[model samples]
Target: MSPEPTVEQLIAAARAGATGDDELALLDAVIAVTKDLSSHADEAVDQVVRQVRAAGHSWTVIGERLGVSRQAARQRYADRVERIREAAATGSVIHGRDLESSLSSALAAARADGLAEAGTEHLLLGLLTDGVAAATLEQLGATRDKIREASHRLFEHPTDWPGGGVPVFSAEAEAALAAARQLANERTPDCAPIIVNTPQLLAVIATNPGSRARRVLNHLGVDVADIKRLLHCYINVPRTPFGRRSRRGRGGKKQRDRCSFCGHPRSEERRLVAGPDVWICAECVALCAEMLAQPADGGV
Candidate 1:
């Protein structure tokens, strides 16, 4: 049997401009294999890198095409390629052709059904097959019935399809996903799956009353505060609380500071300087002073 091409060999070939028609054909084959494994474009590129290395493409040429130095390309993709190989060897849940087929079929079903968005419902349905995600869902106590109940609550009405319409991206879905992507990009630019999932969609709905999406999010244990944080991070929109003072500074005036304990705004009371970061009204100060004068444990 022929010896496998070393990383050094691949880098040398790529740098030497020796990747001719035969090499290109080999690269194309690798690309095709990778595409068969994943519908994502990035994964295709990853597969090409692996194939080129296997076919003796040099890291220098690979890095050149990838817009990175040979060292950088190797550092970034070498471990990933190794992981892919390891996964293939270990019969991991996420590896093999079966999982890919399941994803493709599930996506196809959602598309054929005319779903406008790909939510957790679609993902769950897709996971009905024996895949890594499915295993994770099962371990997480996600059953079809639970998912159905959550979906119904999310939609605010029981229906056969909780996530309605073709799985194609919708303006609303795209906006949400874009917002998530922007936030993720700020934090981790190379993050995958820029789209928001059903869990996120539901959480947003739950935070905002009368939001179908929020209901879904609530059902999934994503509370209003979490949603608010996500919105703050991604949408740049603060979640204003009901009956709370606005944070926006009004003309040159300091924003109204409220008492942490009583929820009383500074405008409502006579200011008493208790301590640094501890402003209290005269009435509250008196009350606290009186309470302090009593026995440490007998104020009740």
Candidate 2:
């Protein structure tokens, strides 16, 4: 691919297009540079802030240089700064494509609802429609309609929600993201450079008692215990040593290989012990024995 145009080159082109009275050319140049600048603005600012702080600059001094109050500066950069530090303390990481899409949908959902910020509830609401988490959520009875009713009931909002700039993530939402990173690491240690996928993100949010996501799930009368146990099976294909599951046989008939107790699916040729209402797959019996051993409290 060709090298990206430099800022100076972009400015020159924009100026030339404007001076030449070519409206279309000018719009193109300006729009291209604006896209690049807007997309990378946060990272660039964070790097600069870190460099100056490392050089022993005080918040007041930095604020003075940036023409903003110290409190304003802290409020603007603190979450991202802390998250970056936290990530370094853990390991290199990033959101997988699926997770990214879910988050984007989360923001879109918040905007559509007329909310100013995307909270954990919004994150859960966003997952109701699409991505890897959708199937599990559907199985748990968290359809789009039900979640919308729950959220609307839990947090009442004005019907005429106003428009705004990009929505900021709530503190709980940020914590859920951090939690997702941790879960992703545990899910795939052998796999280097962990990528946080949809299932991991959903697991973290659903398990966090302090998050609104969990509250929404509870309001919807979901079985959180079942979700947690089932989330283990969605980690990754490499983690599922139970073997590949074949959904079809010679006659093209359907086959069932799911573990009834833990809801562990994606298995192949695994023997399942049939019960009155539930069947336990071989893998679940072997791996989830201890969990099954616990008191059947929480309806486990």
Candidate 3:
């Protein structure tokens, strides 16, 4: 593959794209391009650093790889890591592609109705686009048209309001989004990254009392609790393994005593039963036995 354009090449291109004989304009354009490049570079480095950190690398090792001092590396990236960690804890990481599409659809729905702002009802309608939210709503007989109609009838519309400008989210919609992010963060396992997908958003919208979304669902004769209950079926929050450790042995060597099922090291308290090419720990064996003991009809 060819190399990416250098800063000089990008600046030259920016200058070449300038119109008339305007030195200030050309300089501004070059500066803008430079700033943009710098921002993109910072973002790229931050993302790579985050991935490296996630992969269990320390500041000393990362600093060595970057040809910098450990303290310098930590000082540069530690704040960014802390910011990300705080955001994750507070459920601010809600920029998933699916959720973005739903937000777009929500704005479109608001615009279609000539509404000045996209309300939580519009967000609920948008969740019908795809994913677990759509399937769950469909199962509950909450079609897009039905929701739109119900929202139209239930929510208030301004009589003299002009909807020419882009529709911003209503306060309730914003609250719903925040709630969804919190729900997703809370439901996600510690081992997994938090993501505010359609299901989470939809559940928040449906469950929030006095919201336009909930009102619309009520108008359509659909129970809000049903949305929550149905969503639980689609959400899987895996538990963190007890006493889980690396599959590697001392000095980063591969361990043969690791259980093939859970990848946990075999300890004195938890011995492993070995087969031809697989190993099962005592916990996994007990789990398997319990599962097998269940009747064919799910023990009902």
Candidate 4:
């Protein structure tokens, strides 16, 4: 065996492996990736803010920990923390007629299925009955009747769900509602004070595969992954004036070969629906179909 390694020798060996310009380059790359991680961890930061607030830390103290002034802390995070703490903060957001109908239907679905509280499942079933949302779900194979039937079989009913008071939302349902608000905010920065519509909520739910609503969707043979992909294009991907993100302007007019509403090409979208200028593909048509369907019954 070699002579017993001295501490200084070990230190020198260890430092040599992770030192010099090569190591510095590696460190720089790690720093870049870490910045990306921090940007993506906004939700984690929000959660931690809630935790510290729940522990009764004042803004001043939290600010000190965050290396900011108390006012900065309060301004940056207090309202958001308050919203998470209060259910009514989220519930108070103005909802349209379609939203009102959806909520009422959600409550009704729970009542019909004999569930104690209206969980995300009922909310999803409610969405499946709503105009735009129903159309959006239809693309994922979650038809109104299929999802409704599946919701019934997802859980055994308790006879003692009680008949008197209004159906309250479960914790999970409330979380999903809050997430809907967040998703709407993320998608529409220009539209300040966005009150989520039914389609927006459905967009959020379709991607949340871990939720009870998604499980019910799974039972109905709905392709959750495909729903997620379509909604990502529908809600998250930026649309050009011609409806395709990759499209460019020549003579201030669309020149790209993709749909103005969805990035799908002419092949994926067979019909190639067009307006005065912009065109929407066949796939995206399913999401906005209720724009046509609903006005006929005003609820179709």
| Residue-by-residue lDDT tens digits, candidate 2, 140-222 | 77887888788888887768766867787888788888888877665543423355766777888888787788888999899
lDDT of each: 0.43, 0.60, 0.63, 0.56
Q: Write the residue-wise lDDT of candidate 3 on 1-300 in tens digits.
A: 011222223333345444533443343444444443321233334444665686677898777756689999899998876665666566456355556777999999888888878999899888876555776788889899899878777767666656579898999899898887777666554533465677778878787778888888888889877876655533333223322333565899886576654556679887987643445578755644443233322223
Clashing residue pairs, backbone N/CA/C < 3 A, model 4: 242-260, 243-260, 243-261, 244-260
Tens-digit per-residue lDDT, 210-256, candidate 1: 43334444576644564443223222222232222344485867766
Model 4 stretches astray by more than 4 angstroms: 1-94, 139-141, 191-193, 229-233, 237-260, 263-295, 298-300
* Number of the candidate with higher lDDT, 2 or 3: 3
The CA-based lDDT of model 4 is what?
A: 0.56
**Candidate 4 lDDT by residue in tens digits, 127-189:** 765545665676666766887777667777777756776778888888888887666555432
Q: How many steric overlaps are in each model, in order?
A: 19, 1, 0, 4
Error of 2 at 265 (Å): 16
TM-score-better candidate, 1 vs 4: 4
Query: Which stretches in model 1 have alpha-carbon errors above 4 Å?
Result: 1-57, 60-144, 153-167, 189-213, 220-300
Residues forming the 10-long window of minimal summed lDDT in candidate 4: 1-10
Candidate 3 regions with alpha-carbon error over 4 angstroms: 1-92, 158-161, 235-300
Better of 2 and 3 by TM-score: 3
